[model samples]
Target: MSVLDRIIRTTTADLGARMVRIPAAELEARALMAPRRPSFAAALCAPGLSVIAEHKRRSPSRGAIRVDLELTEIVRDYERGGAAAVSVLTEERHFGGALDDLTEAAWVCGLPLLRKDFVVDRYQLLEARAAGASAVLLIVAALPIRRLEELHGAALDLGLDVLVEVHDAVELDVARSIGARIVGVNNRDLRDFSIDVERTYRLLDGMPAGALVVAESGIRGVDDARRLAAAGVDAVLVGEALMAAPDPRLACEELACACG
Candidate 1:
């Protein structure tokens, strides 16, 4: 099976167990009581190339990325470095992340948080809100068109921003069909885990007009950020490079400055 398929399979099984334990009604109640979060979409819409620094422990392609840094420290550095927002990888099995990570990041940083996970169900949206996330990622490749529409609406109904992610032309069409306002173009092909930084540029023209565009993955440093910014990308979601840097704060500072 492809990596994306495997992760989704595992996520579905794990979600079932979690729902049975906490129940959807309980999650909904907790979400309703949670404090409001900063506007993730608005943050990305700020002038210049906004940076959405990600807190990813690991990935299926590259394993064990900065496992030592505390989640709070990472997020704090991102905020200090002028990141527009933070993305917390909350997928446990493949990414070594947990829902608690989102809660902790929210507690430590004022920046809007994006719960970056394989969101296949609405239950996860409730989990995100209750955990203090301002937004959630809904990948086009991960769900059917009908299901994607349902989850997209569900997230909005809960007052959470949705970063509808698309990797190619077809997926972009699907996003456009759903009228996604915030679209993220992922550079990495999830199936084989190969990355092409040019993928973002190739897909840029096809993005819906007036939509907030975010370039995700394979952003190495300042130059890439500058180029994407010049190309009209509103934001960049960077993880591996920043996470692997010896001084994450300085790395983020350079990228954010480059975009500015």
Candidate 2:
């Protein structure tokens, strides 16, 4: 099986166990269950291209990136530095992140938070809501059409925005078929973990109009974000580059300026 397949399979099993550990009702009772204040989509449409700064410690490919930065300090800086939103990695196995990271970021930073994870079940959506996330990411490569539609609907019911990630044309088509508007073109190929920054531009040719496009992964510097913003993406979700920086706030500011 491909890496994507294996990751999804493992995610499915892990999610099943996670749900049992924290029942849906229990998650709903968390203080964060109330709808988030800011809107990620609204941030995307702000004056310049948006920046979804991240709080991540590691990844499947890069291993450890920022294991020491506390969520309170990192997220506060992102918000202070004018980040459009914050994308907190919630997958523990591959990304040295946890649900507590999401909750902590939300508690610290008032900006909208995207629960970045391989979401495959409705339970996770509810978990996101309870964690004070204003948005959730749904990878088109991981779900079939029916399940995608189901999860999207559930997210809407919870007052959460959905950013559907697509790596290529086929998945993009599936995302559109499911009526996803906020689309993230991931530059990293999950199968082999290879990155081609040009993937966003290449895929932009076939993207449907009216879909808010976001470039995800492999964005390492100001120039990378500048190129993507020049290509007309609504925003960029940059994790590793900023997290690994000595000053994540400065990195975020540079990226935000690059959008111009």
Per-residue lDDT over 68-96 for candidate 1, one digit per residue giving the tens place of the 0 to 100 score: 88988999999999999999999999999
Best by TM-score: 1
Q: Candidate 1: where is the Cα deviation over 4 Å?
A: none
Q: What is the lDDT of candidate 2?
A: 0.85
lDDT of 2 by residue, 1-260 (tens): 87788878878898889878987777767634465658878888887688899888887788888877788999988988778999998887777778888878877788989999999988888888888888999988888889999999889878889999999899988888888879999999989889988889988877777888999998888887777777788898988888999998898888877774
Clash number by candidate, in order: 0, 0
Q: How high is each candidate's TM-score?
A: 0.99, 0.94
Give the Å shift of residue 15 in candidate 1: 0.3
Q: For model 2, where is the 10-residue window of minimal lDDT?
A: 28-37
* Candidate 1: residue 189 Cα off by (Å): 0.5
Q: What is the lDDT of residue 193 in candidate 1?
A: 90
Q: Give the TM-score of candidate 1.
A: 0.99
* Pairs with steric clashes in candidate 1: none
Model 1 score (lDDT): 0.95
Give the Cα lDDT of each candidate. 0.95, 0.85
